[model samples]
Target chain A: MKILVVEDEKQIADFVKKGLTEQGFLVELCDHGDEAMERILDQPYDAIVLDIMLPGRDGLSILKQFRKKGHTTPVILLTARSELDERIEGLNTGADDYLTKPFYVEELTARLHAVLRRSSDEQMSLLQAGDVSVNVLTREVKRRGESVRLTAREFSLLEYLMRSPGRVYTRTQILEHVWGYDFDPNTNLVDVHIQRLRKKVSPDKENPVIETIRGVGYRVCKDGAE
Target chain B: MTPRSFRTRVLLVSVAVSGLVLLGFAWWSWQLLEAFSSLSGLDTELVAGHAWLASHLDAVRWFRREFLFLFALGLVCVLGGSWLLAWYAVRPVDLLIDAAEGITAQDLERRIPQRGAGDEFGRLIDVFNDMLERLEVSFNHATRFSADAAHELKTPLTILQGQLDQALQEAPDGSPLQQNLGRLLEEVQRLKVIIRRLLLLSLADAGRIRVALTPMRLDELLGQVIEDVEILAPELRVIQELEEDAWVDADEALLQQAIQNLVNNAIKYNIDGGKIRFQLFRHEENLRFAIANTSEGIPEEDRRQVFRRFYRADPAHSRKVDGVGLGLSLAREIVRAHQGKLWLADAPEGWVMFVMELPEGAGDGAVESGE
Candidate 1:
């Protein structure tokens, strides 16, 4: 899948492009909204991660232009503003999904996957990784054909991690995905819950299906036994 | 009569009385001259003795001139004395009027002095000075609030940019950069929350936050708050004593925001495994909702200031809980806008309790707004 990242800041733009590329997706970067518009007009991208604050043209205007041109490609808006009004404005302006900036790449990746999956023709109700399976429709989980009980929070965390296999997610990303808009990363809730999910979903707790990419984050290996 | 404003009333009365006296004296002098000329017997006798009268005419004329001169001198003395007395009586007040006109919002430091004689103008000056003092304090508070909001927003943005710059120092592989990028995103969201809240407050300050009043059940509102907080902090136990069918006239959205702020604060400040108790009740023409939680009791001095903008009781100033001190202020504003009162009550057992009271039938949009 080809993705376009429209952000003004060189560092953030490069980071997003490089990260998605390593995940084996074709990536394109533009420094401003106008540049993004010119590039997107020529090449059809699978998705676009657009930042709200951009030079030449703001992301909102660009999003409107794309929608005006009848492009229905999925667009996730990144903003540093967390107000309800701003969220409403972004969604009202044809943004498919909204994520506040300073967000974890993992949650961004996960939300993008979810948005893409949701936009796809057929709703794939099950998200599977190795021996564990998640029922997206029913919000249930099972491992080795045995039912495993998980809290509402645990289910959300597992679903977020399982969506993107072999991709590392930081504690902050996990917190944002599992806990709504009000999580304080200073707390140890992320680590505590990761341990709980390990007990429920991993075949052997010692040799868990979820791998901890130390000093980085946790990831579910795609090659693990399914 | 009732020790009325002497400077205003006395000055008006004096001008009216002086004008009437001058008009009355002029009319009386004219009446006397007409009566003397109309004395028929005296006029005929004076003409008959014209030769004798001519001999004394010069002396009579000299006496007449002397009498007129004396009368003119007396009138001048009386008018001049009254004018000086009136000016003396009203001079202090004229000084005060000039001073009052000079006072403005930007220069609240100007004061009318009680000039030590302890007169009425002095009392007015004292009151005016007190008002200015209060105005200066509130103005400073508002300025500080905006400055603090800017600082809060900038700090997180700086961190996010710094992290991204360092992570992508090389040609980005995306994995190592993604991890740092993720942290940066979280901070940005936090910054956004603070900004949104600050904007909410500013809109409210501008008197532009339109609250849509609708009939709402307090029970459902409190239930939502408890359930949301429980999901966020599962370790805490929350108990609700909501009166069912407790209908209230309010803007459902603003009321919800106020209640959420109260509940969120209680959840954030409470001890681990602590219990939160929420109650909604109606008492004699007022609807009251309160939230109580186990907490380190605020100092007596701090309690009064907890609702102040950007105020935090924690001395360490850690950004852990993400408070810009705008929540309580916003809650207070919302409650006040609903024609209600918001306050923190002193609690026993070192607990903190926040109470909000709304006047019955207040938000029917019929209540006269002080705005």
Candidate 2:
């Protein structure tokens, strides 16, 4: 997928570009706001990663102008402050997601993948394999038509893994996704939580779903092997 | 001695002065009457005025009685009049006291309303409001300071973090270079957390914290917290007593963050195999939650400092207690921003306890909030 990155800080922008490029996405970089707007309008990319503060024109103003004109390409806003209204305002202005600054590129990549999948997929809120069905919008999980309850954290962990099934995620990636940016990476929090999820979902049996990849991380079985 | 009221002090001083003046005038009148009565020709010349004395021919005795009667009546009038005047003079000050009591640091806009009569009290109101304006300016500066510092600091941090993350990925798996980068990145992550929390605190300090209120279930939140506690501290026994259907209005994320902080701290500081008790119930018009955990309790001197930022009860500032820094302080700030209160409370020896109270709320929209 092609991605457009608009950031004024050249060094940070390079880092983002390199990260995305390493992740195997073509990245087009623009440092100036006016040029960024022109480039975005010039041609469409699969997704856009935007910075709030920019030269020539600010990110919000650009978002406003293009969104008013009905640009449908998914956009993720990158900002420095997790201030009170900035996140709400960005989402309301048609941005799909918001990430605070000093963020891991992997975190950004995850968000990019999420927004892209949301745009492309038919059922963005539902993950279904075998007898287990997960509903994101309603937050309902059913195993073989019997309702299964999960705590908030469990639900989040499940949703993150189920978003892209059959894909292995490392411990650090799981920590960033499930806990947050500030969670202690050294702790066995992810392992402990995953264990809880396993016990709750499949008691008295070796769980076919939520397969743990030894020395790597965990993944949801696409085939839901018994 | 008991502290005296300003009204009483004002009344006493004025009454004393008026009483002295009135008594002095009565004394002088009596002395003049004595001088006149002792005059040889006065009894015959002023007989009509001294008729009461004419009956007895002992005019001084009759003058003394009548003058003493007049003195008592005059004293009563002066005393009463002084009291009324004193009350009137201090009425404005009473209003001032009432207004001043309501002006807290969180609300500087609540100024003493101008009386508009350009009197002493009106000028006082103007000056007080002016001072509040100055205070409000300083408060706004404090709020802006955190956000500005975060903005300036994050750019370089982002660059550094991105480079480090990139280098770590490039480094071979489990190599020493990778280990070194991992450690550096963790420190950077820690700095980011500190900065974010500091900003949140500053916003709360200025009473600029923005909360989107929604009806939510504290029991559900507590249930989640319990699950986390179980996973994080399985060796520790948790005795939970939660009131059914007890709900509270909160910003779900912020409130959850606060409660999680409390739970995490309880686990982090507790001795292995310690017991934790969690309780939630409605009290009066508030929903109260209390947590008691077995731990090496805080010293009396340090108990009050638990909610202070970066204040570790350990004197050495020792190897940091794991988790996000300033757990108690941030939790308190979050609770305060919700118009709730969090406090360290007295507990049994060898245990620490905290209580959080929030205004009682209904959970009518809880299910619909899932959208």
Top model number, DockQ: 2
What is the TM-score (0 to 1) of candidate 1? 0.60
Clashing pairs in 1: A19-B174, A82-B192, A101-B185, A102-B184, A102-B185, A102-B186, A103-B185, A103-B186, A104-B182, B114-B122
Q: Write down the TM-score for model 2.
A: 0.74
Task: Output the lDDT of residue B11, model 2.
Answer: 73
lDDT of 2 at B66: 83
Scored against the native two-chain complex, candidate 1 gets a DockQ of 0.14
Could you give candidate 2's per-residue lDDT for residues A1-226 as a string of tens digits? Answer: 9999999899998989987886678999999999999999989899999999999998988988888888989999999865556777787788899898888786787689779888998455667755677888799988878889997888899888776555555666676567642445245778888888877666546545787755556778768522
Collision pairs in model 2: none
Among all windows of ten consecutive residues in candidate 2 chain A, which has the lowest summed lDDT? A179-188
Ten contiguous residues minimizing lDDT sum, candidate 1 chain A: A176-185
Q: Model 1 residue B163 lDDT?
A: 51
Give each model's whole-structure lDDT. Answer: 0.70, 0.79
Badly placed stretches (over 4 Å) of model 1 are: A81-85, A122-125, A144-151, A170-172, A181-188, A191-221, A224-226, B1-276, B280-289, B294-296, B309-342, B356-371
Q: What is the C-alpha DockQ of each candidate?
A: 0.14, 0.34
